[model samples]
Target: MTSPYPPSTSISPSDMAAGAKKPTDLPQAQIDAIIRTKRKAREPKACYPCHARKVKCDRNLPCDGCVKRDHADLCSYERPSKKRAQAFESPAGASTSSAAEPTEYYSYDDIPSRVKPENTHPGPDHLGVGGRVSIARDEWDNVRSRLKEMETTISSLRMGLERAEESPAVGPDSGSVQSAEGASRSKGNSPEREGIHAANTFGKGTVHLGSRSVMAYILNNKSGSDQLQALLEGGILPKLGLDNESATYPFVDLWSSDMSSFDISAVCSALPADGQCRQFFYYYRDISGAIYPVIEDITKFENDLELLLAKRLEAGGVYREDGDQAQTPFGTSIAYLGLLYAVLASGCQSSDLGSKERELTSQVYVCCSYQCLRMTNFLSQPTIEAIQTLLVIGNVLSYNMNPGISYVLLGMTLRMGLALGLHVESSRFSVEERYRRRHTWWSMAWQDSHFSLSYDRPSTTAVSQPNIAYREGSQPGDFSYFETLCKVISLALEVVRIRMLSPNAHITFSSFQEYQERIRQIMIEAKPYLRDPQYCSSSTEHLERVVLKLHSSYFCSELCRPSLKPSAGRADANTVAMRKDCVSNLVTTVDAYIELHNISYHAARSWIALQRAISSAFLLAVVEEAKSDSHVLTALRRLEGIIAQRASSERAYDNGDVATSNITSSDQGMASYDPVTGATNPRGLSHPLSMLPLLRDLAPNLKLNGPNL
Candidate 1:
């Protein structure tokens, strides 16, 4: 059979059936058909070298390419089979085009693009279905892991504190059975003992308790145990088996900042040059200062800035004719730099730049601030500056559509506040220091409460301590209004946690009315400032007042939300009137956002503002479905207009279309938050917080923006 052909190319029965025949017995056409069949069968899966080079594959387990390249061991033909591809099909429905294609033949880039899923872009609601499912699974794993770690850390810390407690007092009278307080008091007459006790007891300065007995004595004297119990019972913190001795004081070591984790040199190198930093700082001072006045003593802050600039210049951060220094000295306190970076980050976000560009700019500064904070060991040291920096970081996160992580950062700030004794109103620190502490405490509370509401979680920063009245001639510049706004928002948050989250919970109308009155008083106090032209002489003042009013209006909307809920049975006339009033409040709230956007479109797009806008729009859309109102329609259109503007700006920026006309062009690209009926959320079937199962296969075009949504 192989008489005329080479022995290696002998035609077997299978080859004969495939049209192969002995060369002497076959026509040229039949021989050519056989050769083509052999060539097609010889196509190889890529060998390692060929794959690495991105050259054509021969499809052989060990193709001639691999044999010639001496890479037989690196050759592979294994890939997902047809059955495996079929398994990837979702239960809802397989993507028909995708399903018909062979898995092994397709590259990831070969997949055709599809339409974007609803609500997955153009705004914060960008957790596409596939992304949401993946993030849920990942966050679930992380939460469980963190919980376990917290449990272990808490248990270990408690044991250490307890063993320290069991040890006898470490002073003059050895093993005397005097109470911890009596012992501490006896030793406190000494100058050094008194200072340590004062600092630890009132959170004045450094809490340097060398012995457990001293710590126990101080804690007991201050009734620290009772405070811990109150915090746990009030649900201000997770029930983490906390001992008062451990809870009230910073562990000084546990969860302490890791210095090595920070790379200051890298952060500095990544930062925009010194000139850009100054520009951002000025912008922050002028604009963001009206909202968050973190840096109180501007003069002292500038002195600190000089030191940072010198260090940066020395580090080759500045381009000067004199040339850069080979070695740069490390600044004493990275905390100051952290604050500066955060301020710049905030300023960049609020800038009149393209969204993508602004985000990138802001992100760089945020990372820089975060790095500086970590390098300075901020967790162990609770300075006003450090707390302020944390607050800024939280705000930045929320602004970037990341509320969950922001909430975690805020929690850390709260814990730091506790460690610093901001909760106690003692005269241990200077009057200025005391004022800073008070403001910082309230700021933390506001952030905690607001973020909790956004995430539908319980408020964690409880304000159970007696309020410290702001002393006359002591309030920082323009801080009074900011403080007042925070106070009002904090009160509204209590309503949020109690009513909106747990609507069925029992509460008397009298208490509710009392809460309402508190809000009313705040609004009344701020009314003159908001309404009086004399009070708001400048644009900043006017804008601040507008922000204050907007928040108050939003608060009123939230306060009336519960009453607007459908009743189980027929509602009375009073109930019906209350519902109508609720609708009116919602309309007013929407109007407030519209008004804010008109006043400052840049400011209106801030995280809190955008959240309020989305919330009101969603509510109005729902209400409109049941009862049509002209006001509701107007509000909806206005909200849509703002969203459209944002979409247009973002699209123009992304497409490199930076002309003013392009940005101003009308856009219909607003993402939807189409409300789901009942208690379900729009995205997933699972509880809003829980991670839902993912689809087996992601459509080719779906993009996921992960947990930020």
Candidate 2:
């Protein structure tokens, strides 16, 4: 080929073709290389609207500035013409595969849209995941809204109660409403008027919030500024790492004239512009004064409180059966229902958690126990319908995936079940007088007439009948009232948690150890207490009952069957005579309660075995008291046989050997949520050793089985 160049630079084709393979007349390779280079160099730079709107435009994806914003997703690049694209197509002019290989095409934003001066994003949830900086946003939005509504109801009722107290002209309805509100508020916030509003998230004392102690939240229709300040210092915008949850509502601090001005706008202002980065704090509570440590060395503080309530009952103490008075914080009927809901919530969520997690168990001991102490007013009222409603709320919350609320509900449920039993065992109240309290929370919430499995209502189901553990009524300090006593343990455990003294809890003689360790060492420390011949071979029993409160959608399932119960005579009516576990003296009062109500002999045996396990604990406590006063020791000495007999009962090891409940037609006490027990540790059940059985029974799938505790 002749060179195209002019004579000065031209060379003959023969002379230039030495290294060129075929001396091609055309430069097809040179053209392909140029096209490849151009394609590799392409860059997207459309417009700002396209970048922000997440759509690609002919102009480009994200220009240089979009890249600077760290939003790589906004980048759209320069493109080649369609003709250029055709250059790479297969010789056949089509892709052979039915489906194209998964190609990684970068997506882009829209072209310039209508411009606006307003902020690009709407409220909190306006942006896509790739373009936002949201942090631990309170997924409690729905909860917050519900809390707001509840607060409104509480405020109105509280006003009525206070006004009623101040004026005889106040009607019962107003007084009752006030009472209800006050109790409920106390549960979430605190009853301690002297404390600040939420200060710390992990539960601690005040942080000297920037303002001089001023009253803010309690002010009527307060400003958002002051509210923000308080919230900045307090509100617990309850965030538990879930989506769509509302923040924990800021509690009204009526007691503090020092902290003033609780404004929501201010609270919002306090929040970071990026709602996720920060959380607003709410409330200032003196945990020592009102909080219950549901999570502690303790497994079920509710059990202790229940025992205490039962003791009171045996002492002939009269409790309000159908009023707000039944709603006391530590062991109120209403709060008790909350405990039942908590139980169901945790039980269900735990099963649903897929791994049988113990998170709910700890939270139960800490968060749920607060009900017994904070809601004293409600417990005092004992409003049956009110108690039932709380359970329904628990059930509703149980469906939530939020573990925090689930934990709180579980604690509430345990307490509620016990309350049901205490009320049933209350001699001072007639069954009809408390019938309203007996209805299940589901029924109360919906007021549904058709709540049943088969034709029978939950309370009347055979398999759902009460266990026999609730049948005994013995003595003051007798462990029989364990259900009520659980409330007391709840209080004690809270005290330990707040004080950080659980580590110093006394387990045995001169032996101080962490409360949890002490609990773990039950068998070890128990050796001394069990050495007494009294606990061995004695038939004395410590019983407790379980009423399968829930019936499956079908009543015939194994979970709902009630087996034949032991036929024990009211044995000795005088067993109702309360023996003083304190110093031998005149009657402080007879404290007698049933041990087992309608459970099987084996279940009763398990209860009895548990008592033996804790025999040393009771003896240890009594012996310690004896050191201070020999007279007290004398009382302990006289009760040896009875106590020993109870211990023997605890030796029953029914684990897998015990039969599943059999639904006998004669079964009674159905749909009951209470459990009765004999060996009520005035200090709470021997460190929750019983929880082991419970954990086991409830494991894998727990909805069908009742736990050992």
Full-model lDDT for every candidate = 0.51, 0.27
Residue by residue across 203-285, what tens digits does model 2's lDDT show?
44322210101111112112222333332333322221111122232122223333433222222122112111111000000
Q: In candidate 2, how many Å is residue 190 off?
A: 18
lDDT for position 80 in model 1: 35
Best candidate according to TM-score = 1
Candidate 1, residues 1-709: lDDT per residue as tens digits?
5498556545456545544444456434334333432332322345444554455655555654555444567665543344455657675687765655434433322322123234434222222212221123454467669879986886688667556644644556221113223233232232111212222122222222211122222123222323322322232111110111112211121222564654455555555666766666665655465665555555777677777787667756642222353222245356776788788888776665666677667767777787777666787767888899888877776666555457656788888888888778887778777777777777777676565444334565643533633544524332356666766766765665554333334334456456668766765655355655467654456556766766776665555454543331225664454456556766676676665555444555556655665555444443423235656665655555455455545555566665632433132221211111112111111011111111001111112223222
TM-score of every candidate relative to the true structure: 0.53, 0.18
Model 2 is weakest, by summed lDDT over 10 consecutive residues, at: 280-289
The 10-residue segment with the lowest total lDDT in model 1: 687-696
Query: Which parts of model 1 have CA positions greater than 4 angstroms off?
Result: 1-263, 296-303, 306-332, 466-471, 474-479, 493-503, 506-516, 532-535, 568-570, 624-627, 660-709
- When superposed on Cα atoms, how far off is each prediction in RMSD? 34.0, 30.6
